[model samples]
Target: MTGGPTLPALPPSLRAPLGLVAVLAALVVSVIGTLYAGHSQPGRVDRWIVSPTADPVGPPWRPVALTLDFLGEPAGSVLLVGVVVAVCLLLRRPRAAVLTVAGVALAVGTTTLLKQLVGRTIHGPDNLSYPSGHTTFFTALGLALALLATDRLGLGRTAGTSLVLCVALLAGAAMGWAEVALGAHYPTDALGGWCTALAVVPATAWLVDRAADRLESAGRPEPR
Candidate 1:
């Protein structure tokens, strides 16, 4: 269902540039993924960020990390999405609700598929971890929220773009840190996951708007 005042379309001036950035971000995920494919060891880049031998997160911060990690899990993700969708509907922002679910789902799905293709393992051969799905989910969620806020506030181009990037960056960094600290993924894997969301969400938002517009147009009565 189309919501009143649909998710604000990215300003026309920003769309082309953002689209290009999305493509480049996606390529970054691909190139790094290919280099590490079928390998379990951390690469030179990963080694530069955090030692492969560092101890897992402990006591004070472990719970915090686990809490963030849990939010990325299936049950937690569902709960989070449900709440967001419910709020969107309450506010008569059904388009925002749809984008929330669709964008996050597409971003996470991209990581899942890439994991299979990249075959980058972390702890063992069976555990694929090229792009971190957890990082993607949080990043996508942040982007969706930022977009909704931007539209609701009628933010200008510079302000809106800044808000969207800042929110997504913070969300991605928070989840990425949790994943790396817990030794679930290499630093590069988290980076790839962050890029995957950056690549997917905007594109998904644009598509959702286009699809909704077309559907609404089709349902409109023709002039007499």
Candidate 2:
């Protein structure tokens, strides 16, 4: 933990563009991957992503499998809610916090509705599995955190933050991959989740921050 050399931080303005690019790429990949997996080889991909294939002699679960189950499950949302609440309290941005919570609800609800509306089968089981829940959760979390990190880093050097944001977003994608890899969902399902995250994360970040200080005069509070 202590051995890594300190990395110079990059500027947020530069980092923001890169982050946007990454998000766009992830969304694209997720979309294509999902569509291909479900539409072309649903049975095969489903088996690959869903069916358990562990060592014959050892335990039934791999670490990755266990980890996926833990994060992708419904319970993760409660934990996410807790984190958001804590972060909002810490930042003293109640409205932004409220927006984040609302965003999550809307995201999850929309995902569910879309899944049903799309009538995309869950592949192996009777489950409705478009838009991997874990992927969405992680994407949303990463987007929020990335925005927060960028704000803190400002328009100055933030290579350190950049690295951190990369890892965070990748981790979220990894979770989605796990779901798809395990056949719990299709790649498109994950992609859909990622898309939802992208569509709203920036807006939520703005909501959380409200108006920039530039809008109001420096010396006076606008209102009570």
TM-score of 2: 0.62
lDDT of 1 by residue, 1-224 (tens): 34485444454444665688689899999899889988889999899999877899999999999999999999999999998888877878877888899999999999999999989898788989989999999999988888877777777777877888899899999999999999999989999999999999889878887888898889899999
**Model 1 regions more than 4 Å off:** 1-14
- Which candidate achieves the best TM-score against the true structure? 1
CA lDDT scores, all candidates in order:
0.87, 0.56
Kindly give the stretch of ten consecutive residues in candidate 1 with the minimal lDDT sum. 5-14
Question: What is the C-alpha local distance difference test score of candidate 2?
Answer: 0.56
**2: Cα error in model 2, Å:** 29
TM-score of each: 0.94, 0.62
Candidate 1 accuracy as lDDT: 0.87
